[model samples]
Target: MQRDRNQIIQAENSLLASYAVRQDETGVREYPEAEHPYRIPLQRDRDRVVHSSAFKRLQYKTQVFVYSVGENYRNRLTHTLEVAGISRTMATALGLNSLLAETIALAHDLGHTPFGHAGQDMLSDLMKDFGGFEHNKQSLRIVTFLETRYPSFPGLNLCGETIKGMMKHGGEYLGSHLGQERKEEGPSLEAQCADVADEIAYTSHDIDDGLEMGYLKLEELSDLHLWSDSFLKVKEEYPDLGGKVLVRSVIRELTNGMVSNMIRTIESRIHQWKISSRADLNFHFQEGKRIATYEPEYWEKVRELKSFLYRTLYRHPSVVVTSDRGRDIIESLFYHFRKQPDSIPETYRQRFETEGLERCVCDFVAGMTDRYAEEMAQSIGFKSKEA
Candidate 1:
């Protein structure tokens, strides 16, 4: 077919909805450069993200269980991949930019500190006196500042749309301090897809992992409306289904049900709100309304499932013990680096001079893998199996 960039962009524009973010309308990169000859802006942005060092580091970063917990649990990288896959499916079904959604989903967790949310929480508390630490902001920082790829730019020089997607992948604008123009509204349809996909991926996979680890029991989860419904459907389909097979079927059905509901609800909202254009969507968002959401009943089910996970799995004593140990390791590493800024790698030491001690230390700590963090902590006499 030999479609050039313009032709590919035109094809995409023709297929996408008016409310979908178009490649042609995307804002330029911070460091302006010539476009790729073959791939469109969003495609190139996705490639850059996939090829980045931070993206690779996600392999060893924690998602729920720490890396040392077991090989069977989902790590940060696997979670990101699942989110991207789900985002692409949702975006395609919604007639939005699937590539953009996938890019955002992949880059969404790039800033997550080692040891999952526990490490991030610890760092956030430590950096409260500074500007505060957040994975959303850190992801932006990695793409725009920390990752020095090309000689002309400090970051990957991704398109503004991709950066915006990353910033708003949580369904809200966290904050942008890189001098980029801030959006007054919520994320675009693609970003919103990525956001929901992140939720779907984690909720389902966490359930799978929890069950595998014996932290959560299927009998207990049956009380949740979402779980009960899926379980009943799977049981009805295969009356003899039992054990892991039944669990897998239920989880698959659960994810499928959520995705189907999300798509249907979004379509209904688009029609109800008369959102025929991107401007309409933006206006609704500016008015503090979401165009992308599940129906009320489905949303309630989601909430119930979340609450159950939090109560039974996330706050379980075993999980809490590991989380607390991770927190202590993060804190120890932060103070150690803060006191000896020169002890950081030369690359980061140079950043310390410009980004200040706290910011540099935070970046260095945030970039570490779970095993690396543990090793660093153990080097300084912190005693623990993981540390």
Candidate 2:
């Protein structure tokens, strides 16, 4: 006999720890629907996210560099995939819901603006009087209202837990879609894993990208405790490693060390607190205790590496020039649409009556890919800042 949804849930439950989210308790949706016969709720949520148009747009979105910078650089789509892979590995090791972790990771960056942080910061400043803009809230907005697919629902109508997990930066979302109630409780172990996974993927991969782009040097990075430790280990293991292979090997070792240390640290916390159920986890969460984190000494090294990247890679002239162009495109588009709302797609134009013109314009601009935004800006008679 074929395994049905109930059988699958049972299997999942058997594998999950007491503190992990139970499959049965999840899947509460805004628009109620019948459960699938074969797939569990989280699996269905993952599929819905994967199928959404917003997810597809990530392919052209920036991660650290603009999409046009290079074919091999990590775009938002590749970064999301890497986060999902790392989160899944961490969740499985901790006996948490790996599927939930992966789903959250997949949907985490669906609302990132075209030029990464540069676009987001510009949009935020432009919209400051209009309630401001943040990617996390934008992500929630996309899944809840922006994405119009189903005839019965305006959004994907993903599971409640999936939505909550996607709110990695926890705070109050102003819109009625998420309500005004302040969420004080911490997220589940799966959500924490996904959040940290994002950190690990970006920190290590950004180093690789910096090296590849010639913006960062190996000698400069050797001063970082985290990089040096990993570099030494990689060099000891592969005596002849050089060039791209050497960089990749070092990054792999760095990633591996971070993941292993994070898992071990979280496991130690779980035992130290004697957390054996969801209720126990909630109790600690209510007490403002963080269950998932690296040891302080190790975390200091990670922070050092991040600070180095911020100073060296992110502030590089080539990257700044590209990001500045992207910001100009976004800002130009924002003003253009504000002046003539009709230029926006009819779908977004219709939102003007209900969500106000500025917000509708912001939503439309936020959804554009890097190249598309540039194209649209040119079509609107806007010139590059450098031009």
- Per-model TM-score on C-alpha atoms: 0.95, 0.97
**lDDT (Cα, tens digit) per residue for candidate 2, span 1-387:** 899999999999999998898899774799998888999999989988899999999999998888777899999999999999999999999999999999999999998899999999999999999989999889988998999889999889988788878775456665544342125445778989999999999998999888988999999999999999999999998998898898899999999999999999999999999999877876888787887888999999999999999999999888899889888889999999999888789998787878899999999999999989988988989998798
Q: What lDDT does each candidate get?
A: 0.88, 0.89
Misplaced by over 4 Å in model 2 are 175-184
- Reference-based TM-score, model 1: 0.95
For model 1, residues 114-176, the per-residue Cα lDDT tens digits are 988999999999999988989988998899889977899998888887887776523334355
RMSD of 2: 1.5
> In candidate 2, which residue pairs get closer than 3 Å at backbone N, Cα or C atoms, i.e. clash?
none
User: After superposing candidate 1, which stretches have Cα over 4 Å from the reference?
Assistant: 169-182, 384-387
The numbered model that scores best in TM-score is 2
Candidate 2 CA-lDDT value? 0.89
